[model samples]
Target: RTYAGLPVLGGDLIVHESASGASRSVDKATDADIEVTDTSAAIAPSGAERSALSAAQAAGDRKTGAEDAPRKVIWAATGKPVLAYETVVTGVRKDGTPSKLHVITDADSGRKLYEFQAVQNGTGTGQHNGKVTVGSVRSGSQWLLKDSARGGHRTYNLKHSWDETKKGSAFYDADNVWGNGKPTIAQTAAVDAHYGAAMTWDYYKKVLGRNGIKGNGKAAYSRVHFGDAYENAFWDDDCFCMTYGDGAGNKKPLTSLDVAGHEMSHGLTSATANLEYSGESGGLNEATSDIFGTAVEFYAKNAKDPGDYLIGEKIDINGDGTPLRYMDKPSKDGLSYDYWKSGVGNDDPHFTSGIANHFFYLLSEGS
Candidate 1:
């Protein structure tokens, strides 16, 4: 993945090996190009991000919040790899989804080479699971939102901030009572996030026999109340955590059980297959999360939020009580496709994902 001591993109793969090491095959990131280039920026780095952002905006890519310093990399998406700068910008999208935009600029020519979204916005649940229990630990007198049994997993509060430097504060309670199932209280969202994380964790470990999101027995963190009036939840592999935004006036938190499972499963996909987040592969990436998320919901079997084939039913993201996505018939959203067409990959991954979502429903529950 390196050429002249710089990282090279589009040169990775996912190998599937049987447990006995008898069967093997390449499963992901197979579009590698045999190209190499030296590492040297021909132009000044001051205007790289500005240029990229300008182009992104002109193309209707909006709501950019944080921009990362440009980093030199060997771009292999082209037949010939050349020194390029990759910049990642984080913000909330117009659909209330958290966004991570990657802008690749040719270092020598100062030409924008490529761009893609890294954030995975997904639908999922539970202002709607009734009162639930979350694992907590006490450090002296104050009870923490951390759960040690589950790989010492912890939850934090972003307080509507998207600052990358800050990891956010931990939720502390004197009596360890946590939230009261109300959205106004700050602890309320934290409870949902913490419980959601716990449920997702238990589902993978107990049902799937996986240790954690990364399968290394370590847990990913969660942050709640991210951004002002934010109405979505997202998973950014760069952050190694799941973030939930308060929906519609900072009152409707998107930290449902299924939502947690969906976002966290994104981490799992990134860790394992890491399917490119565009075209048909991108759509499959999202559907994989949806499949596992629904599995987690069923595994929980919580009486308040019973398992169902519906996605985002509890969040009311559409202003009505309609679920964000329908697995049985994706066209119910009026935007998704029930089956593949010639140019389905051209659609947003969220919409194109309906194809796989529908297939999974039929495969799992059957027509």
Candidate 2:
């Protein structure tokens, strides 16, 4: 039972019923001397909503279009129980990804306490895992580049604009065969991305006995050509989408098969273990993605981009004709650690991930 929205547990007391129909006294798990000083809210609901919106906007660097009214609740997750407000703010981030931020605030002080984004991230199209079949939808005698077989997973062209509020146009073709195997054509990158998503979906389903990234048998979408000369791709948990950017000089797209697997694996990690993206946990998180990405590539058996232990080998992000990181000998990249050591958490996750990456390589292929 709650008192003034604060859980007081049977009005500061709980009666236990014995199997014999006898009543007994049990500890209520709260201090007996604790007093309910303020049963009413000091700040209005509007003030709480504003507090949440302000914090969401500041963190996302964009204006929130809508927000749910604050609801009075008990904030007893930690410390003394206190009256608090929970608000949800919705907006589009600066990177053209949708955001649904849940914010909690102190009821009396209206101070923001907690907030989390709700979108997803991933890989490139300028470089892909070679030729592969993709699911498409037919409408009005035209083939739309959509994965109807895989929960209607679709790809959109962002046109280098960060406006996720409005989805860009879907790629279409008469022949139903997409892409010319070159990044010069926009459809080329889209084809690669779509194919990669399909392959990743299949890898998880067929090999791991998992249904989808979230294990709910639902498909997540992808967005390509995100920004002008954008050099990276990412997943947004709020939007439940993966976005890719055209690489340097707009010549390379990062949508390789392993890249797709790598980015999408981040989603799986979020859904499962939810490792904190910092320090040792963060390194493990990144290494998990790399390990599964390599698994997906091998599972794909794509001839053009043969499966290898090298991550981002096709994208060539380094421009020196070297893959982003190596698993067999992680230190080959001169940044990632090849073995576990003390204080490895002090390094960035990408660098710290090398330790586990090397370990996986050894475990799979042997030293």
Which candidate ranks first by lDDT, i.e. highest?
A: 1
Cα misplacement distance, residue 101 of candidate 1 (Å): 46
Candidates' TM-scores? Answer: 0.65, 0.65
Distance from true location, Cα of 245 in model 1, Å = 0.2
Q: lDDT per model, in order?
A: 0.79, 0.79
For model 2, the local distance difference test gives 0.79
Candidate 1 lDDT, tens digit per residue, 1-367?
5766778787665678889986588753435554544455778666777766776666566776436688888877766667788888765556433456788889988899998875432121236576766667666588777766566678899888977446799988887677777786788888778778878887887688998998888988998888898888999777789999999988788987788899999999999998999999999999988888898889888787788888888888888889999999999889998999999999899999899999999998888
Give the alpha carbon lDDT tens digit for every residue of 150-254 in model 2: 556899999888675546778877777667678778887897788788888978976898988988879888888888888888887888888888888877888
Model 2 — TM-score against the truth? 0.65
Clashing residue pairs in candidate 1 are 125-256, 126-256, 160-227
Per-residue error for 223 in candidate 1, Å, reads 0.3
